[model samples]
Target: MQPTILITGATGGIGIALARLLKDHAQLVLLGRNPQKLTSLQTEFPEARTEALPLTDAQAVQALIETLPALDAVVHCAGEVVLSSIQDSQLEDWESMYQSNVLTALVLTQQALPQLRASRGKVVFVNSGAGLRASPGWGGYAASKFALKALADALRQEEPLISVTTVYPGRTATDMQKQVRDMEHAEYQPEKYVRAEDVAQAIKTVLDMQRPSVIEELSIRPG
Candidate 1:
């Protein structure tokens, strides 16, 4: 039997690409918010299951994971990036990032722990380079990314049996980039953008590795 993989934020961008990349081999389940997007993706891969739910809803997140039959891996790619200077950053924006990036990942991890342990599965985090460094006007996004990275690091240390891999993908070509460009005045030119499929392939490679082998951190930046 093919191993089952659970993915969050699977309706778009990196998540969507990863889903498609893995669909040929794995039993894939995707979680997202848009019904139309989920419907469209499900049509493309009828073998994959779609769960339309916001990550912020704890009850919904818990229910979704608890009902899953089994899982061999989980890729968390559901997140938002809102940029603002530290001085001008609203509490609301910071809260939004925390809820979407930090809390949601934690909730999902907690909910999936049982299934993961049952399979001795892997947990892959779609983190950013911002998670590793700081820059002016990157306070909000950077802080959230750092927290997310820390969570994966801590998990890896505590659960050595379950591979915890964090992939820092630099400025991927996606709608998120457009949002960041508009909100932060940061022009993410295509010349510098890493194709989402490249990141997807990296993930598939990591998953294909032997159980004893582990990739703790992977950084993919455009050359």
Candidate 2:
């Protein structure tokens, strides 16, 4: 049987690209906040299951997990990026980033633990370069990603049967990157950033790894 892979942020640029790559080979469960986009993706990949809901809702995520069959992998792509310097950042901005980037992954992973353990599955986190090193005017977003890295580390240690891979991609060419550039009044040059398809391909490679051979972390930057 083909592996069942669950993808969060299924409507986003990287999420959509990754889904397109895996849909033909895997049983997919696409989760996102937009009902219309989820429906559209479901329509496009008729064999896949789609859920339109907030990933941060613990109860909702648990309920959704209960409905799923055994899963072979989960790709967490849902996150937020709010650019602000430490001095100028508001508590609300930090809170929002924490909830979206960190809490969502935590809750979803916790809820899916049972199924994952059963399959000796893989967990992939699509993190940012900021998680490794924070740059100027990116304090809030970077802090949240740092927490996500910590979470991934803890999960890897706690779940010995499951494989965990954290990918840090530098400035991917996505709508979110455009928003970040607009916030900084910088030039929005998609060519300068990593392509979403490249990130997806890296993920595919990691998922293809066999037991006793695992990639713990991967960092990808634009050429």
Candidate 3:
């Protein structure tokens, strides 16, 4: 049987790119917040299962996980980026970033632990370079991603049965990046950033590694 893989943020650029690559290699379970996008992706890949629900809704996420069969891997690509300096950032912005970037991943991974352990599954977190270092206008976003990095590290240590890989990619050409650029009042240049498909390829490499030798962290930067 093909390995069953779950991808969060299925509607986003990197997530969608990953889906297109993995469709033939695995049985996909695509989860995203947008119903229309999920339906669109489902139509494109009829063999894959699709779920449209807010990742922050813990109970709903748990329920969804309970219905799935043995899972072979989970690729966490859901995240949010808000640009605000420490003095300018509001509590609401911090909360929103935390909920989207860290809390959702925590809740979903906790819910999927059983299935993952049973299959010795791999967990790939699509992190950002912001998680590594904070910039002038990225305080809240960086904090959330830092928390996510911590979670990934803790999970790697605690869950020996499941391999965990955290990927930190530099600026990517995605809608989210466009939003970030708008917030920064910088020019939106897609060509200068990394391609979402390239990041997806890096994730594919992580999942394809040989047993007993796992990549704990992967950092990708545009050339």
Candidate 4:
């Protein structure tokens, strides 16, 4: 049987690209919030199973993971990037960013630990380059990603059998960028951004690593 990979934020962006790329390699268990998008992807990946839920909801996230039998991998691709200066960043916006980038990953990882332990599975975090250091306007988004990186590192130490990989991707051509550019008046040109498919391919390579080998961290930036 093909190994199963549970992918969060499967509606679009790198998540959608990864699902399409890995469809042949793994049985995909897609998770997302939008019913229409979930149904659409389910039709596209007819062989894969799907769960539609807002992952920030702790109970919903836990229940969704509990329903899975055994997973070979879990990819936390669900995240949000909000660019606001520290002084102007609203508390609510920071919380929202944390919910999307940090809490969602935490909730899913915590619940998926048992199945991952059972199979010695992999946990791949789709982090951001902003995670590594501070950027002026990236206070909220960067902070959340930094927290995610710390969590992934700690988890790797605790669960040596279950490999952990964190991917730091630079600006990507996705709806998330569109929202930022549109709402914040930032000049985010999608044409200049990295192709989502590239990130998906990188993730596939990480997943195909041999046993006893782990890609602890990887960074992908567009030239």
As for lDDT, the candidate ahead, 1 or 3, is 3
Candidate 3 global lDDT: 0.92
Selected candidate, larger TM-score, 1 vs 2? 2
How good is model 4 by TM-score? 0.95
Backbone clash count for every predicted candidate, in the order shown = 0, 0, 0, 0
What local lDDT score does residue 93 receive in model 3, on the 0 to 100 scale?
A: 90
TM-score on alpha carbons, each prediction: 0.95, 0.98, 0.98, 0.95
Error of 3 at 217 (Å): 0.3
Model 4, residue pairs in steric clash: none
Which tens-of-lDDT digit does each residue in 1-223 have in candidate 4? 8898999989899999999999998889998888999999988999998888777677887787777777889999988777789889899989998998988888888888888999999999999888998878888888999999999999999997799999999889999879878767878788899899999999999999988888999999989
lDDT of 3 by residue, 128-192 (tens): 99999998988899999999999999999999999999999999999999998999899989999
Q: Tell how far residue 24 is off in model 3, in angstroms.
A: 0.4
By TM-score, how accurate is candidate 1? Answer: 0.95
For model 2, the superposed segments whose C-alpha errors exceed 4 Å read none
What is the Cα-based lDDT of residue 40 in candidate 1?
94
lDDT of 2 by residue, 1-223 (tens): 8999999988977898999999888999998888888888988989999988787788998898888778999999998888888889999999999999999999999999999999999999999999999899998999999999999999999999999999999989999999999999999999999999999999999999999999999999988
| Error in Å for residue 11 of model 1 | 1.1
